[model samples]
Target: MNNKLSLKNINVKYGESLALKSINLDIYKGEFVVLLGSSGAGKSTLLRTINQLNPLTSGELDFFDLGKIRNKKDLQNLRKKTGMIFQQHQLIERNTVFQNVLTGRLGFHSLLRSILPLPKFDQELALDCIDRVNLLDKALVKVKELSGGQQQRVGIARALAQNPSLILADEPIASLDPKTSHQVLSMLKDICKKDNISALTSLHQVDFAKEYGDRIIGLSHGKIVFNGKSDQLSDEILKNIYSSSTITEETNFTSNEVVMV
Candidate 1:
């Protein structure tokens, strides 16, 4: 349970508004952690900051033994170790599944090497990644031809091809149906366990976070409101994390019942 990533008193701001408060987090290797909160709780912001996609305004952020990566070169190397999966499934619609997965090799290849088609070994690696996601049969199919769930699986394959030590997923299952969401998340959990890689996923659903995460960190108003084992989250903690007005508007619904006179 060695720490793979550590954030100490991290803070982020955009102009006058603060995006993240003094947040401290430690992610151990081979652990599955979930950041849970309503929208705008800084879950996405925190994830981006880990990869240095969003710069920290204050405090220390460290990834493994890479040291403090302040320059572009160091940041680029950090990104190689941290792979990101977005909700949109950010694949090139025109590219074949194999081609999309091959893009993950860019971090390992030279600029000139990546400009051309991937090398034979890289191609085999991409295919292996596809097999890991159970999508080897769709390797030749265009990205646009796949369903939403299939596309997200392809995204996972792409991350696998990167040979990442840590994977960050930003609401990866947000766009899928409930059944598909469960399927994709289950696969993601399996992949993380199988690869022995650490994973941090941001999720809007408390139930999914409880089910899939070994640990859950709840954010509220840009601060870490709760951090503990998934089984430890209480109803009171959930209410506090989701107390915003938006949550009431989005999650409040009741099924209609028929009345016979």
Candidate 2:
């Protein structure tokens, strides 16, 4: 597989507190990489930093095709090719499903162009994305009218509309029930595989990670505890990754902390 991203000695800090420390990792094209950790494990920070949402305190990120993300133009270009799926879905409640998904293409347009009606190709892509997530029937319905699962599926459709080479999902199923979480995750995994897009998803459920991840990365107190294939995640490793030390002192030590290698 091609190397989609490379993080070399990555570090991120919020004020004086360190969030991610000395992180070194690489994600390959078409791989579904699952991140497992507690609430303050910096999973969200890591995902955000990839798109330059969170500025790195010190590190070198080599994104595929774009090389190093060094300037404003490179950052903009990186974001244009990267899609983000949030835990809350982040859709405009008053907007229709189609409108919500169509916004994903905004990254590809100029400010003036975004204010205008999207091109026909973008409209068609939005419809295709909606269909892929089985929400074509709900496309015209207001976002507020959809169920939580349906709304999350719309988030998936919006990300799909980006035609992104990579998708970053931060706790995508956090607010979902068990059954709905499975449905959403299964759909996401299938889509990534079918479309050959790389994905980095943070999930709290260890079982779900093992089930859906091509590879699993476990974080603890701003450090990587484990990086291995799903089946290689032994019981002992899980214990180490979710050790009590991470929750008590480390959790309160700083609001953000975690890393990968």
Candidate 3:
């Protein structure tokens, strides 16, 4: 895998409080990397900094064409190539599923065209994205009418419609039931692999990270505690990562799932 995104000594802060501390990492093309940690561990903060959603207080964040984007235009272009998925589906509840998916093309469409109405090609692309997520039947449905899982699928399709080279998913399955979570994660993994796109997903479920990620990174208190292959993640390392005293076998979420050999 070739390096597609790089961050060096990256630090993020909200006013006086620091969110990430001296972060350094490289994300390669077509790699499914997961950020794992408990709440307030800064996993989401680190992921957001990649797409410049949270400005770095210090250090370098470099993308493919924009390099180190400090200007608005450069940041806009950088965002166009990077897709983002949030915990909440973030869909327009009043809009049709097709219209919500078409929002992804706003980056590519001119302001006038997007504001007026989606063009014919844009409509086709939106439909194609909806079909890719297996939601072709829901295209005409209102976003408010869908289940949490279905709405998230819409979110994924929206991101896919952007044709991004890199995807940043912040707790994509955090809101779903166990079965729904499994389905969504499986879909995300399949999409990334099939499309040959890179993804960085922040997950609260350690077992889910182990099962779905090509590489696993564990963070605690804004610092990386573990960075290695998923198979190398022993209980000892996981304890250190979570800083927990009680580590239970029953807590293992991926033990019954298929492990990627």
Candidate 3, superposed: residue stretches over 4 Å from native: 1-3, 244-261
In order, the Cα lDDT scores of the candidates are 0.86, 0.88, 0.85
Root-mean-square deviation (CA) per prediction:
4.4, 5.1, 3.8
| TM-score quality measure for candidate 1 | 0.92
**Model 2, runs deviating above 4 Å:** 244-261
**How would you order the candidates by TM-score, starting with the best?**
2, 1, 3
Winner of 1 and 3 under TM-score: 1
Ranking by lDDT: 2, 1, 3
Kindly list the per-residue Cα lDDT of model 3 for residues 145-214, writing each as its tens digit: 9999999999999999888888899989878888999999999889989998889999877778878989
Off by over 4 Å in 1: 246-261
* Candidate 1 vs 3: which has more lDDT: 1
Give the Å shift of residue 209 in candidate 1: 0.7
Model 3: worst 10 consecutive residues (lDDT sum):
252-261
- Report the C-alpha lDDT of model 2 over 167-239, residue by residue, as the tens digit: 9999999899989999999999999999988999998777788888999998877778899998888756765
Report residue 104 deviation for candidate 2 (angstroms).
Answer: 0.3
Measured with C-alpha atoms, the lDDT of residue 174 in candidate 3 is 78
Q: What are the per-model numbers of colliding residue pairs? A: 0, 1, 0
Model 3 TM-score (2 dp) = 0.91
lDDT of 2 at 143: 99
